[model samples]
Target: MRSEDALANIDVAVLAGGLGTRIRGVLGDTPKVLAPIAGRAFLGHLLDYLSAYGSRRVVLCLGHLADRVTAWLARGDSAGTIDVVCQIEPRPLGTAGALGYVRKELRSGTVLVMNGDTFLDADLRAFVASHRLSGAEASVLCVTVDDASRFGRVEIGPDSRIRRFLEKAPGSGTINAGVYLFSAAFVDRFIAAGAVSLEADVLETLPPGTLNAHIAKARFLDIGTPESLAAAASVIAGRES
Candidate 1:
């Protein structure tokens, strides 16, 4: 199915709850999602991108400076093409826990979740179509980067089933892009099982063939560090142009 069609039934979730300790020196008290990029808040750019794909609604799981982010949303920072909602974490919940915190607000059977600080320039239509075709309970977006030391490696079999997740180490390898598609049922299961870290507590524990891998050779941007954050404006401008 085309992304627009698939997205009509799939809500997008942005995980913006990280402490962003690495970039704190530059941003001060601003939430990482509200960091300025290309003359606009990074969250605005992200919402514009999602709006292009006709995403219906976006549920932002916010922590760290949740109030600031929420205040920005109230100011109409979103692109106005999609409905945006905030789910503030009472306390810091790991990635999986944050999702569980907003479980009641998600209206879709499947949800597309991605990190607020990372952007993957890929065809959402293809990604969504592949996931729907595979019938996997969960699917992860993976990309091969020159240095896997920053992000852990993901091993997928020839069948595209995720086999294992290796801890971050010095090497060039395929790594999770921090974007995932999950069935509501699987998410509920994880919440029930008390899964915390999405990677370690849930993904790593899943059987070898349980997760599908949607590998793409796309430009990946992560604004988690000073260097990367500095480069985001250019990357985002390039994408927009």
Candidate 2:
């Protein structure tokens, strides 16, 4: 399928189940995903960007203050014409586990996975195309950042295979932007494994050739910390999807 066509058909799973330990002080009772940036919920901005995909299906994997997040989603202010639904986790289910919880709802096709707390403006069309071309079970959106110390770095081999996943340290490297494209079969295996982190378990254990990397220097932001959240408003202000 073409990139835009794939995006429209793909099921988008936004991981919003994280407990905002770092930002809870700033946001109080509000879930981290609902933290406002530039006069809108951070999720609003995310959905705005995702609107470009012309996708009408979005599944929010919700935890920690799920009720509040559900209430906000109920207001119907964030998703525009998209159909946004929440899959509340009974308990903390890590990354893969959360996805597993909602596996039944996912259609048979590629699924686009994104981090709710981080925003990386990678080209979806190109990313999806790369995944389709690679014939890998999963593909990661990698970004060449000046400093990779803040995040775990991903090393790409000559064939765009993920060769090494390096630990965080002060330096430069290409890092996973926390966006992924996965085939339905891959997701089924992940869900069957149960209670695993998408990165630490699935990605880390997969063969290098199974995970392709598409590197791009996209506009990015991580609102996991107070410092980043404070900077979000300025960074995202007046930006259009």
Candidate 3:
């Protein structure tokens, strides 16, 4: 699909509600996504990347220091073109549950779900294309890492359907990159169910073929920890240059 078409047809929901507890030792009051990197708020780079690719609409699912996140958005940080909406959570909700909280703000037939604390540098358009081509209710972006021990293993069928998700253990295999595409019908059903974890409650329980995979060789970063956040400047700089 053309870039403009993709922009109009897809809406992005960024799950940024996490409390930044892991890196609180270092960042203190900062929301994870707002963590400083390359002399700018991390969310700015995220928005820039998405906006560069014609992602016009983005909904931020907020929790923890949600007010800070909304304040950041209120600035000119959207970088224009990309429109952003921040939905704050009164209570801590799991990943899927967070989306359920802001189900009303989602507007596209296809909503691209992104983990707030992580960044997967890949083609969002291709991810969307794969989901539609597979004709699945939900599709996850999977990557084969050198070591999946930290994230656990993902066993996918030969047909690109997700077979199983393993626990965090020593292994090198395909893993969910924390990016997903969800169909409207599935989103409505999932939200209606209420208060579900995306991994344990949703994907893990879905039928084999209903949840599909879009595997990509992408650069992944989780800046939720101090070590990763410290190293992020170099990682992001490399991408920029």
Candidate 4:
């Protein structure tokens, strides 16, 4: 099946509930996903990207100022024709836990999960093809960056199987791009808690050879910090254009 077809057949979960402590000073009450990017909420660009891939519905896992996000979604300026729903976290459920909270709501065998604060200009078709060919329960999109110091590196072997996860250090390396495709069973089994992290607690602890690393060269943007947030407008505009 085409990648678009695959995406159309699955559900997408956007983990948008993090406390934007890093960018809080600049955004104040604005949720990270709602931070204005090129005069629109950053989440708008994210939804646009997914829509381009034939995604019809998106489940937004919200927390920490989730009301602001829901209000924006209601206005419907950015969502266009996509079906967007908000699943407000009862509390801060970390990354993995938030997905766990909405696991039952997801209605697909395979699901796409993304961090709401980051964007990757990648080929979803190729990534999806890799995941299917590898037969892994989960796949992490990995990107090579000039400086992986700000992000933890994902170590993968020659076969593209994830070997281990490395802590952030000053060096160039392949880092997790924060986009993941997982089998629903994997989410239910490993990410089944209300206070777990997708990174440290799950991916990092998973046994080697169990996860696939879908490598790609893409323009990646993370709007977690003030400086990165400032750069997002131009990057988002360029990508959307």
Instruction: Assess every candidate by TM-score.
Output: 0.97, 0.95, 0.95, 0.95
What lDDT would candidate 3 get against the real structure? 0.84
Question: Ten-residue segment with the worst summed lDDT in candidate 1?
Answer: 1-10
| Candidate maximizing TM-score | 1
lDDT of 1 by residue, 1-67 (tens): 5555657778988999999999999999998999999899999999888887778799999988999
Put down candidate 2 lDDT per residue, 114-186, tens digits, no spaces.
9999987777888888998999889999998777789999878899999879899897778999999999999
Superposition error at 129 for model 2 (Å): 0.8
| Whole-model lDDT, model 4 | 0.88
Q: Which pairs in model 2 have colliding backbones? A: none
Instruction: For each of the candidates, give the backbone clash count.
Output: 0, 0, 1, 0
Backbone clash total, candidate 4: 0
Clashing pairs in 1: none
lDDT of 4 by residue, 36-148 (tens): 98998888888888887878778999989998988887787765757787899888888888888888779989999999999888988888889999999899999998888
Residues 100-219, model 3: lDDT tens digits: 888889988888899978876787778778888998889999888776776857788889998888788775778899988988899888778774698888888877666888888787
Task: Say which prediction, candidate 1 or candidate 3, comes out ahead on TM-score.
Answer: 1
Off by over 4 Å in 3: 3-5
What are the lDDT figures for the candidates, one per model?
Answer: 0.90, 0.86, 0.84, 0.88
